[model samples]
Target chain A: MTGGYMGRILFVNLSTGEIREEVLEENICRDFIGGYGIGARIIYDRQAAGVDPLGPDNTLGLITGPLTGTPATTGTRYQAVGKSPLTGGWGDANSGGFFGPYLKFAGYDAVFFNGIAEKPVYLFVDNGKAELRDASHIWGKDTYETEDTLKAELGRGVEIACIGPASEKLSLISGIITRRGAAAARSGLGAVMGSKKLKAVAVRGNQKVPVADKERADRLRSEQIAEMRTPVAGGQSFIERFHKYGTSSGAHRSALSGDTPVKNWGGIGVVDFPEPDSLGGDNAIANLAGRAGCWRCPIACEGRLKEGTGEYRYPAGTRRVEYETQASFGTMCLNNNIESVNMANHICNSYGLDTISAGCTIAFAIECYENGLITRADTDGIEMTWGNHQAIVAMTEKLAKREGFGDVLADGVKVAAGKIGRGAEQYAVHIGGQELGMHDPKLISPRRPSQPSAARYQADATPGRHTQGFGPSGFRGHFLNAAGLCMMGQMAADPTKYLVGFMSAVTGWECTMDELLKAGERIANMRHVFNLREGINPIEWQVHPRITGNPPQEEGPLAGVTADIKAQVYWNLGALDWDMITAKPSRRKLLELGLDDIARELWP
Target chain B: MTSRGSCGLKPDSHRLNTSWYEGSRRGQEWKYCPMFRCVVGVFGLPREVTELREVEIELEDGARLRDIIAALRREIPALEGDIICAGEDRLTDNYAFNINGRFYQDENELQVRPGDRVALLLLASGG
Candidate 1:
């Protein structure tokens, strides 16, 4: 058996109240690795085609990778996998906090939840014992309140992954929040959890995750830490900057250089939001009450904001706003009020909402209102104007509660556009149903014909995600996520110096770079195959003309820069050996990746 | 020393290239004396760390990308050993060199024409 896994999986059916414990096979662990790798494989085999994502038939897996709770630096992530209620295809979201490690310690490698409970319930896993407890009292509470309530009842040591009011209302843009505000906040999996009438999964355990070669693992960890401590080509180490500023440090530069989308991808950054320095590193850390790290991560990037004292007041200790949140609320809506943006972050965290979708939705609303497509009456008397910080925060809280106009936007821009019809689709900037990440694709250099960053947005299995599908680098990223390693961890250290070495030590596998690459490719293919079986055609996915710069912008840093998305997508497809039109991986390629069964299933 | 130098700019004239002067030297009044100047945009690094967001660098007539980088290292003490390694023109995988909208991953042979826009930017990866 592999050293990292708990060798156990819990399959709980809420509808029938059937609780079954199954042995996690070593072959499955070795073949797929862990996290979404194992999740994608299992869901593809077990779930039927076209199963309603919010229905009982759709299974949800909360999975952690082998390195999750181990001595590996930033081994602090877990994946939430199911058919996405948002994209309606292959879906997965990962979060970093204490929950993933605690779940492993609670004596399970993964937990698969199915069916709707007769009443609201929460799963309690203590040591090696697991059971369902009534959760009626905490169902309506926000995530922060729910955490406090559960901890008071369960114990202070328990780590929880739970939904808030937004999820309970089944907002499609909702997600699961843990440990105050760390969110697995994409794919609308929170709606899936809510649909199952499950509120939370609280875990506490003391078991240590076994490492095959503890000596080697410890040595590699020390070496990696030392490398991180050593300054980069620049005097300051990457970890030093990350620990100090987090992603907020990148916000100003991203905006100025055209990497960050401004005015909902329709306006330019430098021209629209000239003074972005206020939102950058120095200001980002101005209100930092403390630093937050996941598990044993040395690069404690996440920060706790000091209490709000201005107009938009929020409680102290709210999770600091990340770059994505900053862009989505700051430049995207043209609202530069730091306090309001911070308050918006607070609202989203408390309600368990995806800030990307929520912020983008508000920007969409602002555009719609400006065009006279909607009015103050529709917004419940709040003027949905660009840079109206008060209105933005008001609308965000309304969206969290799913009230009035908020109900129209709670699902995201894609769904809101559908409801508002009269040419509102033209203003909706989304790929499929998910809002594009804060990064802009038009910023890609024209010299690089096959730039992976630009194309990954459209070609990745989960369309519109910035983090997935980077040809070869993406393969490693998939494996990293599966291994429960934080991307920040990989970024801080020289991964070539320690990534494969650390994995080999922890899993007791003679995992060479070649072998790890193949595993990553296999994992990527498995995820793509899941989408193919669901009848999603990658060729037909439409990227907004504004995003592609169809009729190039007249000003700003990215002026006249139109992304050749179709060519890039085709290039990506050819590289992956997938049929361009059908978007299915070739049988030969699948077989080469050791996906013999998947190859047969597709080729058959 | 001629008031109108080789590049045809006055020694103490208000040529006012704020990008360079404001960032590197915040308050000191200095004369622009170089025969050739290229505007360099610094991206992906924080203002506090780099001290200069953008700066116009003085280089020799046949300056290449490496020379501009070397000049930047010498002028900006914060960036001396950070973006590019000391005494090495090659950039690690973490950084990229973008000149006139074209990106060079590790290419050191690219010629830097006078008045070219050279940007020292971090490669987009990671969160």
Candidate 2:
């Protein structure tokens, strides 16, 4: 019955070319909640241990949170789940776009895709029905062309998530792009789709999100939109700057605070940063194109930049220059030119790849060449130097295709480092072989807030990163994996401190902060258990040796810093049971966590 | 030339002082940042409130946002809490302060400019 709220879940066995819809067990809803929580369960149950990450066995799932498509201002959030080809760990990446709302409109809580199709196929859903269609023609196209091709085939009303040539080749750092530029990037989940022979997932839904109390959801969303519109933030919030310049606006603040690393940390004069802006940083505003927002979100923090746009006149024009892109392509590569940053972001998006991993691998290559560990003969005879935008752009396209020197950096830092020896691996800063590298958080930097950058390298073992242990107001929080809602919305609404009762009313789960957090924790715990089944080591949670230095520097919060990691915190925090704040995890705690099947599966 | 030069450091440099605006604008910040920055535009008030002395509005902990109205009922009687934060939304206490013309959400130790106005507006949740 609709009374119990079992949003329909559709499963398409691609290898069998069969589509079937099922009513999900109410327990799945109660236990997993929504967003990455449900994503964790789906990946844990459907995926097999030691299954080649780039094979048909690695299931790719599209999921939405319970609050998705509801009256929440930032409610249109979605998640894609699979085993990461990048790190060989469980993959969970989410994005803010119209796809989540459309999934809810299609009258389904989730769509689980498995097995490899005989030919390239795109799954299309309208209202309550789903169909698998041929996508042979659009398979090798770039992300933007894929969407355009799908829209032309399925009508303009459809929303699609598609990959590019890089993904089809099973690149370890690939992503699914939506809204042309927004990415469900990282974790190499796109490789999973490529392996499954899936070209895209397109949907158009007109159905309403079933809410027990529509009035309450409306009131709450209205309240949140109002709270987020103010600007009294001491001009200190990166989110404010994020709205102004995507996430890259934070580069100025972090660099000013001296928390940013520049020119591969090989000492500054090589790239003009040993002294702050003795060279080319303040001139970066020339790259600021404008701002963008996600579906129904009020704080438009997504920046759309290009080189030739108005104030930022470098010919790159408005694409999207987020903070990590700036760090990786600008500071990390010693190419502080704003036009270079804009070009790098566009290159990553067009290639259907993760900007974080792509940037890090290239930076590592530059360092190796600089150290004379690798000669110009090894680098396609082109000198690997920082502040060289032309060299960086050429390499981005090359890496995606695994061509020339690009082939070495194609497998990400961990794998690529193994190929290029001679102390080169030390600077290839990645956590758990996945690159969600440490960056400055708002307010307190690394040391003052004690936010875990040291633990970041270990984050591949965590259930979901980027979405966990972040957001300034929440301080510490997790993503909601139900119908659909973005982390941006979750942070703005203060869900960690406030969404317990609010979520319970809509989903009828009667949730508390402890219960909500437990759901997030249980899902995270399930990820570790799933990764363990695949032979992953839990102790590898650490930052790069280059980052966790000896005689630590003396400037930022991370200045004079060293990391002290604890595996128990990683496991316990996943269950929302930190002994300092919450109760300890007793044997009875295992019983309280429920999911007896999961406990039996993990322990047995 | 932007240094404090011969300008004497005012008492309560961190407090509300409007007369600090009487001298050249370049010499205010002698030690750290010397620029006189304006508050963000989302405060729903005048960007340059020059007439006010020192405006101080206490910030409620973000953990207790729902309680801002009850706290404001006693602190500032000039406006009704219900009007500030409509029944559906609460815009009050989302911001820090104008501390001597510099708009700060929770500036804590940030310095203030002279002849400036401090107005409290809702702090934006930009993430």
For each prediction in turn, the share of the native Cα contacts (below 8 Å between chains A and B) that it retains comes to 0.12, 0.01
Worst 10 residues of 2 chain A by lDDT: A440-449
Task: Give lDDT per model, in order.
Answer: 0.82, 0.60
Two-chain complex of model 1, DockQ on C-alpha atoms against the true structure = 0.15
Off by over 4 Å in 1: A445-451, B1-126
DockQ of each: 0.15, 0.04
**Position A100, candidate 1: lDDT:** 96
Clash number by candidate, in order? 4, 38
Candidate 2, residues A78-112: lDDT per residue as tens digits?
A: 88887888777778777877887777777787898
Clashing residue pairs in candidate 1 are: A233-B81, A233-B82, A234-B82, A235-B82
- For model 2, the chain A TM-score is 0.88
